[model samples]
Target chain A: MDSTCRRMRAEILDISFSSGHGHIPTCFSVVECLYAAYEVMRHDPKRPDWAERDRFVLSKGHAALGYYAVLAQHSYFDIKEVAGFGAYNSRFGCHADRTKLPGVEASTGSLGHGIGIAVGMALGERVAGRQTKVFTLIGDGESNEGSVWEAVMVANNVGLNNLTIIYDHNKSQGRCLPVTNPGERFRSFGCEVVEVNGHNVDALKEVFARPATGVRAVIADTVKGYGCKTLVDNVNEWHRKSPDAEQLAKLLEELHAPAI
Target chain B: MRRQFKETTTALAATDPRVAVVLGDVSVYMFMDFHRANPGKFYNMGICENSLISVAAGMTATGMRPFVHTIAPFLTERSLEQIKLDCAYNQWPVNIVTCGASFDYAWDGATHHCYTDLAILRLLPNMEVLQPGSRREVDALMRATYDSGKPTYIRLSDHPHDVETNLEFGKGTVLREGKSGVTVMTAGPILPNVMAACEDLDVNLVYFHTLKPMDRALVERFRHDRILVVHDAFGLQEAINEVPGLRTWYHGLPDQFCAWYGTVHDIRARIGLDAPGIRKAVTTLLETPSA
Candidate 1:
């Protein structure tokens, strides 16, 4: 991993561990997706709401730390704001709050609402005569929601070629269940579905860079805790469990030391 | 009144690019012309009311002022959390226009009946709830809604009302002035029934088109001493609570769902919301002195 991605991951680890309030497994899984998304998606940290800037909404919002880390690294706000993650008086809520963060597009912690919100933005951007693309990161588990399907129809019907969704296809859903193949469903909805290895940042960036023929869904095959050995081996347990101080320090040293 | 809403909205959207209509798969007849004229601006968001509302909120982010249309029950009650969290919480100026209030779809059963929209919406922080009584009130309210710059809900009824309306958004119009002893205030399509019920009485008649920023001063003054409030939905009691002291008589639907299936008048009469019912309640109350 590069130094910038490593540093962002370390910051996510520290904030989640310190706050004792974050979707750690979910956050770790999408580090590469976020790393790659910002690479291809157009955005200026200084002008978050610039009329022509591409908009990204974290539909699976419990993993807000992962998104927040990227925003911090991009200099949207001081890195110090990350230290207060999940605090009583902090802007960083357990779920993403748009009012609290400038770059955060929609206040989405609820499952199934993000893609619809993104499609709305795509619709709005189209009507306004802007070429800004809309990107959304949705969990594989979130695809089960009926509203997600509802949004899929709208996107395909409207031919939202400006919108792209990268599904964090981590296979396992809540330990008890597993996710079915998403490509078939997305393809059935008339979306141009593409399968890719989510951990490969270069591959993730390549798919988004292509000319979107229609509403595209990139099904990213990922592990729940991709980088850290501790969380990945026990993905369900670590999904909501933030590491304690000693566990966090040992994991951070291993992750930051770059032997993974 | 619903036809007035349809005409005003479609006409306004032609001239104003900022105006957009979002639907949860209701009111297709009213919006057929709108869809053809402005296809990009019209969004038929299917039957998912929750997604419909949140999508409308998202549209507002990109410099579009959205007007969401649907059946009153589904728009306000089914997806109420989205209205409060997505729209009102962020103070997005989206207009939620609802059709079929009270017993408008009474025979369609309990699911189609919406009697709690006013009460539920009135509790939200930045929401202004309005149930206009006539076509003119609908026209005036729609004009004001475009510029209000806050989340607003416009509840309309199939039944029409004519009470000489002058609907200034937050203020009420005095239809009849009487001695200080009695004041009868009502809102929405039920105003006509209230008007007929109070014909023989020497009481003040005040009509409110806007429910949230209600004429609080008028209510505090007239209702503080003695007043009778007639509202189509469950919000009358809460609207009266704004001014503490009062000998108040409220006529509204009960909190429970309407389980009975009947015509609009049958259900309204059964629930004591019809002309005879209002007259009986008003006459009995008028006989008593102010506490």
Candidate 2:
């Protein structure tokens, strides 16, 4: 894992521990994906509502902590401000609200919605004759929704070469309704499917920067809890769990340790 | 009304570069001219109703005023979450104009019937619900609220009444005044049946096209009277009841699915929404002692 993503994993853990809110495993799954997207996206953190900037929607909205941490890294806001996650009067909620937050394009908590919105944004770009690209990240579990496939089909059929759908294939739904062979599924839906190591920020940045024909789908094969062994091994139990003081220490220790 | 939708929207699109249409493959033929003229702005984007709404919301985010059209039940009911989350909650100005209101698709069976759209959609925060009952009303309301920067729902029915209305978006019309303390309030295309039913009857008549910000001041005017909300759908009575202490009774659909397959008139006649049947309901309400 890159040093920035590892530090973000630590921030996600600290915030989740302090707030006692978040789907930590899910957040861990998409940190690098979110970081990579922002790295390539033409956006100004100061001017999130910049008219001509590229757009990103977190379709798998449960991973908002990860998104927030990554956005904080990008200077959208300070990392310390995210301590109020899921608290009253906090801009950062368990799920993102676009009206409340600066960088959030669409308020998405319900699965399978952001991708469709992203497709529409791409279409809007096409209609306006602008080259503004739109990107969205969807969970493997969220892919179970028929609306996900519905959007995938629409994006391709509309010939949205400006839209890129990043599938967080963390095997989160391996216990039930797994989206087996997501690359094949996206290809079948007429996307330019790119399979990659999700935790590798460089690899993700490469795919995001590369040109495409029609809607692009990046199948980021990822571990549910990437950097920490305890969380990685027991992903199902830690899926929506927040870490305690002692557990937070262990997780941080695991995060900073060299990869085995 | 659909023809008026094409005309009004085509005229709007001629000047307003931001005006676009996203169809769920329901009225592609009707919008052929629109598709030809504004090819980039029009999309007959397959039968996916959910995507139609979400996509329009996306378009709205980009400063485009999108009119998302489809059959009522599929567009409103099936893609309801998309409407609630993407358009309403996100506060996108998506104009959802749907056809096949209530039993307009009567021969297509209960699957095509959509009576819950207005009632359910009005509950969403910052949503505008309009049921235009004539070509004039459709043209008027669409022109007024199409780019109003609010998520608006304009339901167009094939069977529109010819009665000239207030043409205002949220205000109700006082079509008749009577000495009796009974008011027959109805909305949408069923106003003609309601008009014909109450024409000879000694009762006050009221009508509405906007159900969300329902003319509460007008409904309050009849608060002392027995307001019998006569309509073919569930929303008008609920809107009237929003004004407190008014004795309002719904003379609309029952709890059962309208299972029979036939024409809209046949279904309306059977369900006591036709001229004579509505007259009978009004007379029954008037004759019964106030409780």
TM-score of chain B of 1: 0.95
Give the candidate number with the greatest DockQ: 2
Q: Per-residue CA lDDT of candidate 1, range B10-84, in tens?
A: 888888988988887787767888889887888776787877877787788788988888898888888887888
Chain A of model 2, TM-score against the native? 0.98
Query: TM-score of B chain for each model?
Result: 0.95, 0.98
Candidate 2 residue lDDT tens string, A185-208: 999989999999998899999999
TM-score of each: 0.95, 0.99
Worst 10 residues of 1 chain A by lDDT: A171-180
